[model samples]
Target: MPEFPHDDTTTNPFAAEPQDRLDANPRRAIVTGADSGIGRATAVALAAAGVDVALTWHSDETGAQETADEVRTHGARAVVARLDVTDIPACGDVVDGLIDELGGLDVFVNNAGAGLQTPFLDVALDEWNRVLDTDLTGPFVCLQRAARAMVAAGRGGRLIAVTSVHEHQPMVGASAYDAAKHGLGGLMKNLALELGHHGISAVSVAPGEIATPMTGQTDTDPRTEDRPGIPLGRPGDAREVAALIAFLASPEAAYISGASVVIDGGMLQMGPQAGAAVDTHDWRTL
Candidate 1:
């Protein structure tokens, strides 16, 4: 075998000194779409971990207040704000404002997202724009602002996006949703690479069939529902996903960057098996 040349001058970009990892204990965090579901759960979970939380809601101020109340029950300070991710650059200002209110930032979770069930041929320009802006472009702006705050604070940080299993696999009528998630996944990966030198880590949490308002299953107990296709035989609860997100924001997960952690109860593994088992053409429609 021929000898492989190594560039000795290039050091490990991910290496950081103990002093550079100041935010290892993550004092503060911001969670978007926190009025309900995964966002609310994440807020509460982070609070339980002793991290103060700033939560954002779009149209449900009441629900946001409820989340804040729960966070406060954990003895953690909670701030509430409105965040419409589809609003583009204006949405970024909301993130900055939240950071200012929280005093600083250590963990930023881009959990606000929208989904569409329209087929590819029926997806209109307006709908496409809305989904794309909400899921991808808006997250870009918000994450950028959060990253800047982290860099300015000179503390290590965590940037996490709540993607979907569709980030890796496609569904019947989720053309726009899938595309946006794919883009967001790629964006997190790139952020991980670029921010590593700053002692910041970026990751994506890709969930499967979760029992949340977005799934038309509000106030549901996922354990009671049956999902034969999934190895776990049930839909996931928002709290379960929240636990994972909270762990990722902790110092223990410092090395887990640029990864799409799937908490789907093994739903993606059944793809080929499900495809072969289906004896009808029903899979082609929503």
Candidate 2:
């Protein structure tokens, strides 16, 4: 696991922008993988901005409930659901059910993802399938269902996916993950073109080295985390990433679609060569 703070929810002092920053809308959303990390923070931020949020968790019901509880503190209705994004047949049902529960859906954040850290030559077929299924195929199904819902409702909507820096750059020992991310980026582009006529906008937010449970860090203060490789010299707070998502979900971003906005503390600016030349850390085992 990556090193993260235990009380991470409080780490980022810049978590919530003024509620007025959000353009008014249905104020309803569904966030997948809301049990932790970027998903949880996005949910909380949306709720704070008066968006009723329905959150889904794969295994961590406790974490899901905790997130929901925080959402409610903002006076927004929060629902908890069980979801496995890779479960294709269930995607439509789950998405529709959440929309029904929320009265309607205005935003869908595809944040649930799986990754592989094996060398390209060593990656087994099963591992490859799992990464593609969860990272690429899952978002495809979810986006389709969500876009259809938004279209049928005749109300404009927001579709945001939490991609990674890998979406734009390759990483050592992450062949499967990189391929899946690239596919996801392409999918979002297609969705924007396909859904724009229906008043729906599709976009992807790419982040690098976020402090989350998946990285073996939970609730840790990123400000104190010494990360020499990152231009900011520290890991990004999950809430910081969430703040960006909240902004994109706002009606202010209506004109923005098919964009892959990166929030990596300028990490991508450092190419693979710079990584080898500057950071002594080996990324292969990551």
Candidate 3:
């Protein structure tokens, strides 16, 4: 593997000691779709790291406010906004409003997304367009706005997107989601290439089989017997994915850019053969 270059040149007059990096607080961050699941978890994680958060949710003001309260409880300032990623102009407005409300933005997390669970052959054109718009275009717009501000400020920044494992692998009954996530990863890579010279790093976090409401899985013991293909033999929690995002956004990961990190509990390592050869004895139980 070729090593990437690290830019360690910083001439901040008021910069804190290197060892006390974590003690330094970031002014603000924006996390979209933060009303539930991974988005909520990531918002809280950033707050715990002493970053004020501007969170957005659609059709769930109460949930969004609840997450904002959690951020406050973590000793970080919080602001909640209603946003629909499908509305392109609204994305820019939201970023502007959040920056105005929070003073400035140092990090932006594009976690808003939608999925359609239908066979590819049965999907409609509108369904495809809707997913692509929300998953890919929304992030692109938000990223553009955030990058402009970060570059203008010349303060360096972090841009991250919560994609899905489908970014790299395809799934049946999830054509739109797969295509959108793939596009998202590509978008991040392109942005990373362009933004690197400006001291802004772009990254994508792809998660797999996370235990969230979207999976329709109850809050029960994660299954292992039926999930032998995964090397870890279980599903991942939203917080586990959040932890990775937090790291990606941290100063420690400054040298990492244009990278799509997959957190799948080793599921991606298991090809279809592992699940296909399940014992007949297990089939009887199902």
Clashes of each: 0, 12, 0
> Residue by residue across 172-230, what tens digits does model 1's lDDT show?
89999999999999999999999988888999999999999999899999989988999
- Predictions in order: lDDT: 0.94, 0.87, 0.84
Give me the runs in candidate 2 sitting further than 4 Å from their true place. Answer: 1-24, 272-286
Q: Residue pairs in steric clash, candidate 3?
A: none
Cα miss at 105, model 2 (Å)? 0.7
CA error at residue 165 for candidate 1, angstroms: 0.3
TM-scores for every candidate against the unseen true structure: 0.94, 0.88, 0.86
Cα error of candidate 3 at position 13, Å: 20
Cα error of candidate 2 at position 52, Å: 0.3
What ordering of candidates by lDDT runs from best to worst? 1, 2, 3
What are the C-alpha RMSDs, in order, of all predicted structures?
3.4, 11.2, 5.2
Q: Cα miss at 130, model 1 (Å)?
A: 0.3
Best by lDDT: 1
Q: Considering every candidate listed, which one attains the maximal TM-score? A: 1
lDDT of 3 at 86: 89
User: Which residue pairs in candidate 1 collide?
Assistant: none
TM-score of 1: 0.94
